[model samples]
Target: MQGSTHGIPIDTDKSSPIIVDLIYRLKIRDVMTSTILSCRPEQTMQDAQKLMKDNSITGVPVMVERRLVGIVSMDDVINALMTGTMGQPIEKHMSRQVIVLEDDMPLSFGISWLDKYRYGRFPVLNAKKELVGIITSRDIIVTLLLEMNKEIERFEEATSHREASTSGFHLEYTTRRFDFEMAGRLSTETKRQLKERDLPPKIIRRVAVAAYELEMNQVVHSAGGTVRVVYDGNQGRVEILAQDTGPGIPDVESALSEGFSTATEWVRSLGFGAGMGLPNTQRVSDAFSIESSPAGTCVKVTIATEERSNP
Candidate 1:
């Protein structure tokens, strides 16, 4: 929960630069394979293995009367084969405590679940807890790559009308509650702009991390918010402001505490609210300020284009 990056203390934050690339405004149902190949719990292990081989899939969801019961994978088959239990009922060999994904959940939840559990695939269920589809890490990778390319195309189109050598640029983006699909697009664009300006890598990195964390915090925690970025060539600094009209933080001091979180389980599932946003932003910024009340919250983070040499 406590670590240092290039000697800068990192709290319970787990936001990664690579996360900006993976974050998309997508839901699990958007990418899940709706036509699932599955078996029944009463089926024999040999039968399940044959189904897996016929479909060329490593795993299959086990359903019993439209309810998800378990999942059987190639590893289970191999174990059964070794133990001479191939003819046994699949329910006896399959993993009963299956980690499943819901249809409406964000793609980030799937990404986090796979990364945390190292599962080859997950059985997706609907609101009624019925097996609806299946998704694999490959699906997530392909979808994210496509989304990233689309974002790049959009960024190019948006910037095409602007003067290339403009002294400064100011932009604002709106974020909505649970808007996971569009979470990191603005930050990615900001990073692109910084790269075009040829800012120092350290500065760009700090801005990228700050922008991503702020964007995600708004998307996950706020009712709705506006993220504004102002780059000043004269001052050699980029300023980011996030203002949200959500239920504001009651205790700013406690919210900044490492590992402190009031996020719901659903939010935590998508990998936010480990109590790192404000602290991480402050750590990377040249200046930071925050204000909150029941009506709303506003956070301002400023990073200089010039990197500060390590003392």
Candidate 2:
């Protein structure tokens, strides 16, 4: 089974630049909860249940000093309770066959293991093979989202420094508001063109994301707009412009905030706007900007053609 790496369901090998960079950048040790509450081998099953209840957790590692001996899940406790064994020592009912994640392993490995084992959490072991912390799927999710938010904020701060470049190729497409069906056509075409030109996969992905976000913003929020693509073959840069005719965004500052949007209820139900458009575009682009007025809104994104897109 494919491991989901993000809230939007990402693959370990392929995903948004922001996410791929994040998963690779982080390690299991960084995300796991270091302050662990545990149950000892001699502790009763009833004790494990209480520990879980008090901490709002589903599983407790049975520990001997600093060593992890086994894990007793809520399921084990329930079975023990129904079978009238809640009074039994936790070690007796705990799953002796433990799966663990190494502290130094990449977060991607943790994600895959969580998916593969279908476990609610895994014990984390240091090089000396001592239990250092515990990691859960929820832990992975929360860290990624929080880190992504911080990274996006950093990108937004850099948007004022637009890349200085000259254009080599140009193309434009008209986008109708609420045109969900055809919304991604421009980015799709742009990606294919870049791929045919033998551009690096990494840069191609950043350009595709920048173009798609710009295109999607116009389609989902603007009245009607034009998506312009300017590819500089010399510098290997892709500049995209998404400009709408009218009914401009009332608050540009609020619009740029992630998870803030003006998309209608029906549009949101279709999953169009969780308010990541501008943030995502700005995040992927090496240079970005947004200008709006009662007449219209225009978003600009620039991604370099170099293999190291951001550098």
Candidate 3:
């Protein structure tokens, strides 16, 4: 194999190749160049060409009955032109010989296959054979670079989370039988962490808002709860757990509604009974789940360090 200009050594000329670790971990989801662009196998070659031109891509996956059955590249088109075939369908010229990888497979196997087989790109699919993503040499290289950076960041963060968790500092608070005063405290703590770590403000805000609402739900309805804050340089997360032994809300759907509250008169006096708690919590969280029972209620909230757009 020929080494890339990027100074990556590859025995490209060899029939059998082994990929190195530096190149393997580059398949990290956050980093990876992929062509989400695809074309149906039955589509005309012209349509396939149009898709490639529009996306500025050299190749496109071929789908049949919504399943990835093959792939077609620019080289296929050239072969058609040279053979006096211009108006053929994609399936007629596309390479039915398909190669794929799982999302969790190490980048090494993918790289080795690519090098040994002389493929420009490969599709990434799950066990269900669903087309989740694509991987190319460029994508692999980019992923490698990103993994290197993320590794350093994770190491730094591990040190910080350890220091904070072991700082021998204890902060505790008690919530009344039914009150929401301490609901925003966890969020405030998370915000402070974001500012201290210089995380993106937009992402921090979303995490904080989500954490606060989850915290408030516990305080307002549950018996009590606690929050543990941790930060690792690349990301920060907050874990909040609230629990109580009370008759849980009968209808989870109504409880999750915006502007829906069942607070008693005394509880509502604190301006804490707005029905936005559950809905707002879900809105701000990257992942949201709930479980409850009549005997007691428990809620857990988590906040990520990175910013994500609402779904």
Per-model TM against the reference: 0.53, 0.50, 0.43
| Alpha-carbon runs more than 4 Å astray in model 2 | 1-14, 163-311
Candidate 3 residue-wise lDDT, 97-207, digit = tens:
888777777666666767677888888886787887888878777666666666665675566456564222122234545555445655675676566657688777876
Give stretches of model 3 more than 4 Å off: 1-35, 152-311
Order of the predicted models by TM-score, top scorer first: 1, 2, 3
Instruction: Give the higher-TM-score candidate: 1 or 3.
Output: 1
lDDT per residue as tens, model 2, 131-221: 8999998999899888987887578435522442233556677889888877887787778667767888988888888888878888887
Clashes of 3: 10
Residue 47 CA error for candidate 2 (Å)? 0.8
**Cα-based lDDT at residue 135, candidate 2:** 98
lDDT of 1 at 89: 95
The number of the candidate with the highest TM-score is 1
What TM-score does candidate 1 get on C-alpha atoms? 0.53
Clashes of 1: 4
What's the lDDT for candidate 2?
Answer: 0.84
lDDT of 1 by residue, 1-311 (tens): 13322222222146554444244348899888899888898899999999999888999999888988899999999999999999999999999999999999877678778867888999998998888899998888888788877777666657742744576777678999989888887788788888878888888989989988899888878898999888999988899999999799889998887788888898898788888987888898989999999899999998888765772
